[model samples]
Target: MTINPLEYSAASHPGLMRDNNEDCFLSQPEHGLWLVADGMGGHEAGEVASAIVRDTIERETHENPAISLLDTIQHAHATILKSAAQGIGAPGMGSTVVALKSNSESYQVAWVGDSRAYLWTPSREGGRLERLSTDHSYVQMLVETGVIRAEDAEFHPEKNIITQCLGMQELPQVRVDFVEHQWHKDQWILLCSDGLTDEVNDKTIAQILFESNNCLAAVDQLLHAALTGGGRDNITLQIIESPLRDNPLRKGLWQWVPYLTGKTLVDAWIFGAALASLVSILFYVMYF
Candidate 1:
């Protein structure tokens, strides 16, 4: 059966309080892949760690078109470890990652640490906003065990303390989760760094998505909301809108660019390849 083409947009900002942004994201509609990684450490190490995680996963996915999503994340984890050992960044540098991949019939969402994936679908009563991925953070554990109320989690002092991440001194006891669901009309998927959630509330996020004209506008409004709500940390968001597809292979034409990096449409392989190289060089020179 034919399905509708997927539409997506991504944006990232350094936020008001931070001097550098330690977040990286990917939106490859052609390959049905999207990701958000948030790095944690001092100085430029955090950014380097996140970049390594994002680049590694992108390379692995592009090379083996059929690689398992779970395996791909593990590969990224291994690469991050190697980079840290080489002193590319701080010894404790690490990152949290959330990824989404889909086929014609269904989609897969995976993640480690506190980055999140949310699913929104239209309904007869009103649209629904559901958090598809659970956070691997200390406060999340407290909330799960009834030690704290969900409402209080946001203000908890340990809210930013994630239990698992990409790289650490010991081989990370990565607890990756996978969520699989079939596609439907008017369904949208959101991947974001903790910066967005830490600032904008759930209700505000749903309101913005429902009111926005397109996926791109939704991304813009989401970033605006985070900045307006304090913007204490780096903020990033990627929104994927799947209208019911009526064509074979779900092909469409549009430009996909990483907001922080230079623009290169995903359909243009030559330009995209060169841009990828430039990004690596820029990362090494800027941070190292």
Candidate 2:
């Protein structure tokens, strides 16, 4: 059996403006499955929609490990629609979902509506924070058609108007978008709802991820940043790290050696001597 090497952290918040959280997340590192769902509708209906999406995918993926994530999401979509049709939730209830699946060799991301996925690579690996999924929203359409710049879409008046999502009555079938990439030990994958993106920009998110010592810290910092940014809507996020990579902060310590040594030659010599002694002790302990 191939042992899974994945570490992850997740968080969800109701935000400052909402009374209840209509967001849900799933993290099953052993299964290499992660997901985020943002619900739409008034009252408790939105919560019900998101919960259905979360539960359906979770159950389906667990039952059949080899099932495609695309099919799993489609199953969730049908479940949510059926629930609403059967009056389980309010009429017209729906949800946006973004999911990530990975194995020892590669990763795949799938999404619908404005929920998103991102990849962060460390500086040694070309240092990039990339968005892996596109929004299925009115603003995105406007941006694509050249009616508005991509930057302006964030603040567009109809930015929240999604073109597609799970459980929409008018649509007969949901459309899913997907992307695949080779998995690397030095990279991280992020799945999130629009709440975080609506408040925190991508640059700030990249900085937080870069500075964090581990997946848990990264998730905490990202959640704090979103709440600090006004917390206008329900917020949810997940950060998944590659288990093959050592602690990122430890790997990055060498970059701080010069700063730690200070400006003077004497300081550098002292620091070097201390580092050498520490290494000697570690070597002795290991060898003896």
Say which candidate scores most in TM-score.
2
How much is the lDDT of residue 63 in candidate 2?
A: 95
What is the Cα-based lDDT of residue 163 in candidate 2? 97
**Model 1 spans > 4 angstroms off:** 243-288
TM-score list, all predictions: 0.82, 0.86
Model 2 lDDT-worst window of ten: 254-263
lDDT of 1 by residue, 191-215 (tens): 9999999999889999988777578
What lDDT, from 0 to 1, does candidate 2 have? 0.87
For model 1, give the 10-residue run with minimal summed lDDT. Answer: 248-257
Please provide, for model 2 over 40-98, each residue's C-alpha lDDT reduced to its tens digit, 9 standing for 90 to 100: 99778888998998899889889999999999888888888888878898999999999
Shift in Å, residue 7, candidate 2: 0.4
Global CA lDDT computed for model 1: 0.85
Per lDDT, the best of the predicted structures is 2
